[model samples]
Target: MSRIVILAEGSFQFHAAKTAVGVIRYSKDTVVAVIDSTKAGQDVAQALQTNFGIGIPIVRDIREALPYQPDTLLIGIAPRGGNLPAAWRWQLLTAIEAGMNIVSGLHFFLSDDEELRQAAEKHGVMLYDVRRPPEKKVVANYTPHRAGSHTILAVGSDCSTGKMTTMLELEQTARQRGLNSAFVATGQTGIMISGNGLPIDHIICDFLAGMVEEMVLDFCEKYDWVFVEGQGALNHPGYSPVTLGLLHGTLPDAMIFCHIAGATTIDGYQHCPLPSLPEMIRMNEDAVNWLHPHHNSKVVGISLLTHHLSEAEAHAEIQRIEQETGLPTVDVLRFGADPLVDAIQRYFNA
Candidate 1:
């Protein structure tokens, strides 16, 4: 059995740690332990109950938790303002000295922080700064109707967020509009689609050469519109660039980009080592410039995944993105009945 210890101190780290546990729950080889210094000597049992409603004990220090001999120590602690804390730096060193492989979602762990990053690398540890692949349980019995045209509203953030629920709601919205829409689980996990209650197969695995073209062509022949949901995090393994490439090749009539706006979005840009959002917009412009020569499809608009944001905050974020990128942005939640329905109608018309 492989033991994995998650070191969490702050609220955000605690949530992220729990999410990681959820992602790896199916693995029989993994055992997870949560460590928090503030809660030391207290009943790990009781603390877990209060914090996460779990039975895992919250040990006070890493040394006390070391008896379990975890093979992997996942550091859920992040540096304030994107800088690793001095104490956490020492704790990571201690973990390595204790012979545990370390993994972290901390930006510094993933960044070019030479001192700490190099130290961890020297210990032969794997530092994974990437988001965990979404854990979607497949409903094997779910078989979608073989329709001629179907619209799939796959919702997920470019980062970890409420993509699943957004996708589900989009499906509901489609159904309300009298469109035969389905929620497709292109992510690694399977989700139950509304209406038909069928399981949206993960196209990453199920799709073969020409399979996408065949599916799209068939759906167009049978259904009025097909709404395919995109996955969260463009870099996630479950997020197949190839799938997006295929969609582009097949020439979808319209494309909608969903952006999840939360307090995290403000700092997300700092954590992302890739091109900034502005750069991405520029790249999109360049790509559009080249692709539009042969293809003809409009980038319908950007939708905000506002699961927890207030109306004002959501609107502000949308406005910011619109102002920055010169692309129309809509708050998916605020669009409500009239605007969402109208957008759907207009999308189909385009």
Candidate 2:
């Protein structure tokens, strides 16, 4: 049977540990052990029993856990400002040396760490950052035909909070406006759709740069509107950095930022502390400043993905953000299609 080990730092004890356990269980592979020095000697089985109800021992050190000879190692160590911790790096290197495949969610794994990536490549060990899937094969000859009055609306958040659903809703909303819109999966979880009767390639792999340019050009030429979704979490490789980078030179006429106001989003903002609200606000402002100035693009509006907030609470949050940023905000669920179209029209007209 295949076996896997999990290593996590103190910072990732709660969420990362839980995620690691789920991956192991879903893989149908035996979980050899969990290594958390702070929680050493504690029964991994009992510690995780509350969450997973499965018994697995928690060991103090990698050496102690190695006797089981795991086939894979999942690292759940917290990133140090987007970089891997030295201890975690050492652990990964050791695991690779031991001939175990490594998978991690650390952002540094997607960085310019040639040594780390090359070492794993040399060992023929697969490393999945979990933020972005490995690149896939692209179709070389596929080219999208230009359509008249077609506008591709691409909306992305700084993170991964309800991006998929929001994009889908935007598609439906566009259809109500008598405009043809389809969802394109630029990231790992996005759906594939045909454009102008041609099968569009996956955004992340095939035509990331080309698609952005082509879509923008197509929007200028053919379709009424196109809606592209953005994710919430910035640390993930499949998030907006790449998409935004591709849009640097060729930006759409307008863009919308989606903000989620739910329990998950609140917890993500508060406890998880991936990207704080203030930081995100500042980031969006910066992005707007750059695009608005350089590319002559405008921030059309902001959409609230209210999964849990009451109408009053949601409006209050939107009001606060609008007052601070001086930008119009629309509660996607409450405003329906008219407000969205108005926002799009106002910005495009400006």
Candidate 3:
């Protein structure tokens, strides 16, 4: 396992810092430090406002983190367009000069950058582009999910709305109930936690659905239910393609609609207001139906991320959503996933 020093820099704990937070929570790689100049001299827990139960220092730059002896420098921020910022280049160059390998999930491939490429070659360090799709030619083949595999896909109102977290929580709840279930991780965070999964967004659009279909089919014989971790939102202008592919590919029986309470718009796109919860539900249903008209998928539950709200406010919001949608609803993390799990069990009459 590589010892990774995350370069989150200006974006720690914010939406852009999602990849950083994921590594902090799930990476098997030793996370010696996080390079966030804004949060320098602070513990990661303190900066994030949640105790990770581990000590991870936040430093100002790569030089400050060198003492921790990280072999890999992982870029943990996914800015819009997946472009590497001009300001971050110097620090990244410094890390490469120090013989640290680079790992990035951005669409802007580090290997494509001449300076980064030459420096890495000079230092004999590898650059792992996590989001680059496989080069081999492939075709998208549609197949309905086989019966008896009660699959649930965690579709969200917007990107970074806790789809992965909800899926993991549901899977954990299933295990505690002694039911046979498996989690199908489709992103970096989920893959790190589960130790295996395809990064669906990285794949070319033509093969995205086929890849999901293959993954779901592979898991069917082994588990009674498979919870697929959904990607971007159908309403998200930037990431809707991957979202639609996962919906059509998995063709799940049920969906747990995820939304961040009080979020009027997407995290970065303030100008683009979010559609109503009912509309988001309809969008997902329409996508699934368009792919598999026979598969009558419905939103079975609502998973709200209420971390920004007070406990009472969250509870009230939960009640409001339940009353409005006539669906079981809960904040998966604030309260245990029991309500959501019970909702799904009730749906399947388990």
Candidate 4:
């Protein structure tokens, strides 16, 4: 596994630094340090106000991290529009010049950029653009998945609502319980963790569903259970298409609705109010049923993200949501995924 130094720079909050957080929490690779000049001297745990990267030092720049002898620099934020920030260019080049591989999840392909690509070649380093979609094109095959296959998708109230985290925990818990489970990744962070999945958001719009279908089908061939990491939200102005593609292509037998507790509106779009939980549930289920009435898929559980809540508060919110939606609700990470797993099993076994 690579020794990673995450580059979050100016954006290092909980939501903005999701890539760095995800890689630290889930990746087997060692995260030696993090780069965020503003938070210099503080560890990632302190900066994020979470325990994810407990003792890892948060440094000021690429040069400061060189002493750690990190072989890789991971671009640790998926910025809006997925473009590489011009300010980060010199940091990446410096890393490359020092023979450190660059792993970026940006839509701007570092490998395709002449300067960076050439620098990488000259230095005998590599640039990994995880968001680059596969070259092949195939339309989604609208058909039933194989018999005995069970799939559950994570849908959410908005982006960064813990969809991938929920799905990942579900898969792990299911596997630990002796079930043959697979996690189908659909985003750059998920890909970084699972090492298998299309950057569905970067794939051509026409082939997005097809790409998802192929991944689900392949996993379903082997695993009895498939937990797909979802992207975006049904009501998101920018990301609804990716959400719909996953819904239609995977035809999940069950869905987990994810939401950050107490969130009133979409992050970065405060003017756009969020739908009521019940209404969002209705919209998601309706979208699926309207497309494939045969699937009879439903939101089987709620994965409420309560990282901001106290333990007591998190429990209270979970209970309140359960009473409101009448579905199994859990934090998954804070608590456990047993309730949601039970819901999926019950839904499928029924």
Per-prediction TM-score: 0.45, 0.46, 0.89, 0.96
Model 4 spans with C-alpha error above 4 angstroms: none
- Model 2 lDDT tens row, 258-293: 666543333344544345444554554465446446
Give me the candidate number with maximum TM-score: 4
10 residues in a row with least lDDT, candidate 2: 191-200
Off by over 4 Å in 2: 1-157, 180-183, 192-207, 215-221, 231-240, 262-295
> For each candidate, what is the lDDT?
0.49, 0.54, 0.85, 0.91
Per-residue lDDT value at 188 in model 1: 29
Ranking by TM-score: 4, 3, 2, 1
RMSD of candidate 3 to the truth, in angstroms, is 2.5
Each model's total of backbone clashes = 18, 27, 0, 0
RMSD in Å for all candidates: 11.7, 10.4, 2.5, 1.4
Two-way lDDT contest, 2 vs 4, winner: 4
For candidate 3, the lDDT comes to 0.85
List where candidate 3 sits over 4 angstroms from the true fold: 188-195, 266-272
In candidate 1, which residue ranges exceed 4 Å CA deviation?
1-157, 161-164, 188-190, 194-209, 232-246, 262-295, 325-328, 333-341, 347-350
The lDDT ranking, best first, is: 4, 3, 2, 1
lDDT at residue 241 of model 1 (Cα atoms): 59
Report the lDDT tens digits of candidate 1 across residue range 210-304.
34444445555656666554444443344435434433323444445555564333224556444454553344333333444433444445566
